[model samples]
Target: MSSEHERGDKKGQFCSIPAKPKCGDCPHPKDYIEVCKPTGWFDHTFKRFVNAKDPFTFEKKFEAHHLVCVAPVTQILLSNDGINSVIEQTKWCINNKDNMIAMPLWGHTVKWYCEVEESISVDEVADVINDAMKAPKFKNIPQHDYDHNCKEGYTWEVEVEVEKLADKVKEQGHKLKGKALEGKLNKLSSDFRSRLLDDRGTRKGGTHAAWKLAQKEPPDPDWCQPFSMASDSKVSSKGFPVRVFNGQVAKWVNRIAKAISSGV
Candidate 1:
């Protein structure tokens, strides 16, 4: 087993943990996951109006073998690198595991965050993000915004695809109102899923990239330099959705721990 001091150099690029070399300068737990709650204006406003409660805390702890990866939840939901970031981080956690590493869990919810040690210019980050957003996964985003519920934030890729289907119908000179349009979308969605259920092509775009990366040979040193969404339905009357905490972190950690113990 590695000493707590040794874990610092082994942490992921975006790890939320305090760096081992710098741990003496901080008071946070050296072995536990740290929830990041930035003090920016957007975050402050959201918490003030939406989720007034403090960040979630977990009663459960991670096993020694766990090498968890955390991503910036806000960036993944709104930035150009959103999809790419999650998939990339997940793959990193999976591919970099060793015998001591087990139950590679990833945190994707809004409260999670990551940082880079090296200084990177905003423009460089934006360029990579723009490229990610332009990937085939988001090809169907309409030229114009069809839904005006920006209060809850932008819709997911699935919603964008449904809107695209509606646009195609409109282009064909067929006007279907309300239920009729809803029915058509339902059918389209069902058909699309049915066809893709057994095909690897269904995982195209960001997911596909992650899948491909996982298949490649592991890095010689098993290390790499660090690089660094919300649903509407549950919106509160405050005009934004409040974050939900339901022991998810504990569940995730336990699931991974179980897998490792079972030799999975």
Candidate 2:
């Protein structure tokens, strides 16, 4: 039979031997020798001997073979560098086609045997195997660093400065205490003014009392009053009421008013 058919048969069959014959002492052996097995021998030998090993170990071997088989199919999908290396190796294989088998298992098994036999070093074979295995995952190469920054690209900077300005609102004492006092003063002023308006309307005439009383009633479920001033006033003896007329404070108040008007 042809060598390929003979190898195929050997891998598919099993036969019993009298005993483990010594290579140097066999009577029928000559200077040159060829060992051959019938069809299904390797499969049967594997089932009887190799399968007895731990299942996890056998699974890893199966996975390795699977990776090797899938490698060539994905070679073109890899990067330029990876594709070039595979193309070069394939060209070499083409030139040596007469001496080699192109089947995935044959290629992978030959590579393994070559490395074990020292016909090729482990490192050299490993480089080729690694490139092949990585061919499928080549598209997912990382482009960013761990710090969320780009590599070999633009850099960024932040600048900050501290400066003093005139007429700034400076709370010389405790800021929380100052804000409490200011809130109390605003509440007191609002309550006093509202009371004055009510008394003034009562003194004006009875005609204005109805309108004033209606305004003083709580607002409707859907409609609301524009302002609801608080009724409390407490401030430090040294504190005086001051109103901002310009700059940042005015801008801040304008922003707050706009936000409130937007109902957001």
Candidate 3:
């Protein structure tokens, strides 16, 4: 394994990324995956709020690999160059048995409450989070996570954490939603998710709540068009009205006029 601390020039060890990198990944996606980041934020630096930012953490793609990549985002460097350089130099120190040097070029920092590779779904990464870290003797997240170590006064809100974890699991089931709009719309909180989703909904004039939309349901083919009306009708032998609709409306001008005047 590469020594995270021992590199001669530690300048790029944790590259100071620019506002937006070439890679498309973001710790904050246009629509962040819900539940994963929504819950379990234990504030260490400032007064905590519901859904406050939590320190990022992730399980590496490979068991032995330490370096991983994410897509572009606010904190990533101007490009992948800085992280690429760091990865190259680190390869010399670590065995890099899995040839993970390519990740820096393709990914970004795993700097959210939770994250995974550029292509992996949050569900996949989250599913094995426990198993992947267990054998490696890594800490469990949110509660036991060491990234944002809790001091004596730092509170562990079990109820809030449990809510977030449950919400995260429920969010994974909504993979059909666009990445930009997954978990940001809980009815309960006015945190970032609610705010971001509401703003996005207004900006695009779309339904703010994703679940309220029926994307899989077929469109009403005749919607917005006038409903057909029978130009003429007669009593059938069975006593049911025998109606025929025709496009020759002028033939029934007086009737059509009466129908239109009646608000039919």
Candidate with top TM-score is 1
* lDDT (C-alpha) at residue 160 in model 1: 53
For candidate 1, the 10 contiguous residues with the lowest summed lDDT are 219-228
Best by lDDT: 1
TM value for model 2: 0.12
Error of 1 at 144 (Å): 26
Compared with the true structure, what per-residue lDDT tens digits does model 3 show for residues 140-214?
Answer: 111111111123111122223323533453446533222222222122223322222333222212221111111
lDDT digits (tens) for residues 1-264 of candidate 1: 113322322122223232323344233333222222112211211011122276443422222221121212112211223132322232112111121111111221111211210133444433332343222221111111111123432233334554454455445554443345435534544443332222212323322243222223441111100000112231212211111123222333345334322323
List the candidate 3 regions with Cα displacement exceeding 4 Å: 1-148, 151-168, 171-176, 179-264
* Model 1: pairs clashing at backbone N, Cα or C within 3 Å: none
**Cα error, candidate 3, residue 58 (Å):** 30
Cα deviation at 116, candidate 3, in Å, is 46
Clash count for each candidate, listed in order shown: 0, 8, 13
How far in Å is the alpha carbon of 34 misplaced in model 3? 24
What does candidate 1 score on TM? 0.21
Residue-level lDDT tens digits of model 2 in 1-264: 122221111001111111124123323332111122212212221011133356332211110011011112122111123222322222111011121111111112222323332443434433433243221111111111111112211111000000010001122222322334333323333433333224321222321222122222241221111111111121011111122222122232344334332323
Worst 10 residues of 3 by lDDT: 227-236
